[model samples]
Target: MAPIDLNLLTALDALLAERSVTGAARRMGLSVSAMSRTLTRLRTATGDPLLVQAGRSLVPTPYAETLAERVHAVAQEARAVLGPASQAIDPLSLERTFTIRANEGFVALFAPAIITAIQQAAPHVRLRFAPKPDKAATPLRDGMIDLEIGTAGASAPEMRTQLLFRDRFVGVARRDHPLFAGPVTAERYAACAHVAASRRGAWTGPVDEGLHALGLRRRVIAIVPGFLDALAIARQSDLIALVPRSCCHRGGVATEGLQSFDLPVPTPELAICVMWHPRLDADPAHRWLRQKLMALCRMPA
Candidate 1:
């Protein structure tokens, strides 16, 4: 038996990623003919067709799709192993920006603490908070986001994560609202006009689920995209808003005109987390950032 050709692995990963031989060739700066030969070599070496033509396009075989990510990861790891050791990070001397993608509520709740902590240790470092309109990791994979803070969703298995905090839902309205003056029941809570926070614009959520379980439903008069928007409308109107207790206590939301009460039904508690690409798992600066965040998160309630 012959030893595996390590160079071919890079070619294989690239080919699988692009599917098309010509596209992969352009990516690797090889001519179409050269890429075709490499693809032939790959098929012989792996004993898989890897990619098959479909009309004018090429598509990866199921096996090839499965290997694509792993192959890319393996090649990156090998490169890191052969490369020079990562240099020690100088917090004070470092001058770089880290972009964080998060929902509006999370940013309002945690950004100040994170920014202050980073500034205290690394004065030259800058932080950019970007809006996360949906649960997608494309920004992280593309190197646009240095970190993400939210409830863990369908993330790539290779991504790394750490729990930040646990938050439960709370019903909020104006401070002097009639609901605040009496024992709030499920029926009473459901009777009020509600402001729903539906990122996808759907007027339903865990609150609705809990209400459904109790054979009750709230009268949602308006649907907003984020917690901040919901809270804003609730503060000025008679509408009730279901908000995360932790978020409600954040600087922006924890203001006059807001009064929060426990939801009458048991709702799921969201486990907030910080996520990053596995490639940055061992980076000194990234490690430092994660540490600061973890420490802040662990502070007494």
Candidate 2:
């Protein structure tokens, strides 16, 4: 079967409303001859003389009058479809799972705030937090994860990102560690055994580089996969754990049991960001999630 030409509906609707060939042509940015030919096609399609001359003016036939309102409605809907898109996300009515892939430290740090905020706004929405084992973009590109939060490394150049906050590494250990007895100088900080957080376990990291600047190095007795594990070891033993101050949490407080002391030597500050594929940049639900995450992150720390 031959497909129906949608443009013909617009011409019929306009010609019926205006009741003048010249007027319909002007409204459609076409000449009178072009509109007359369109009217001929419309007549053949509908098998009716949709518009007839009434002296110097044009009048709509009974069939044209019957289809006027419906055609106009269809034309309006088509125009909207061709125009700019809309954001009609209804959070309260939405029910879907949003997968977020992030490092263990980030999930431990930011998940509570994000969960609370999302739950309060959208009761039915579910959050799936996936652990990021490495820096790769395949999950995002393939839609396995709705969002990825962490430092935007060289992984996903095509992803869109919004900076959430800046974080710096801090030395943390048991409350009664001897480093608290005096100033945490490079020598004192380097003398203690440390727990290094390296998923790949190569040994050297930001803290080591900072110590290198002072011609000092700490003994990394053990290498762990994540900061939380290192913190757990440091909490029980005398091992020193270097972790991001932003991710350390205590009950009802931003910085608690963790003793955050400025690094004796310089270390690069890392920016925390929320990243997602550019394809979802304008998606209403994705936009809501991004906005909620950004707002929740801005809360006083």
The candidate that achieves the highest TM-score relative to the unseen native structure: 2
Q: What is the per-residue lDDT of model 2 for residues 1-301, given as tens digits with 9 covering 90 to 100? A: 8998989989988898899999999999999999999999999999999899889998999888899999999999998988777888789998989999888877777788889889989999999999888878999999999998888574578889899888888888888888889999999999999999988996877978878867898888999998888888887888888888775642234334556678787788888889999999988898999999988887766
Task: Please list all clashing residue pairs in model 2, or write none if there are none.
Answer: none
- Candidate 1 residue lDDT tens string, 10-70: 7887888787888888988999999999999999988999899899988899998889889
Error of 1 at 225 (Å): 1.5
Off by over 4 Å in 1: 1-87, 252-254
Clashes of each: 0, 0
Instruction: Specify the poorest-scoring 10-residue window by lDDT in model 2.
Output: 249-258
Candidate 1: clashing pairs of residues? none
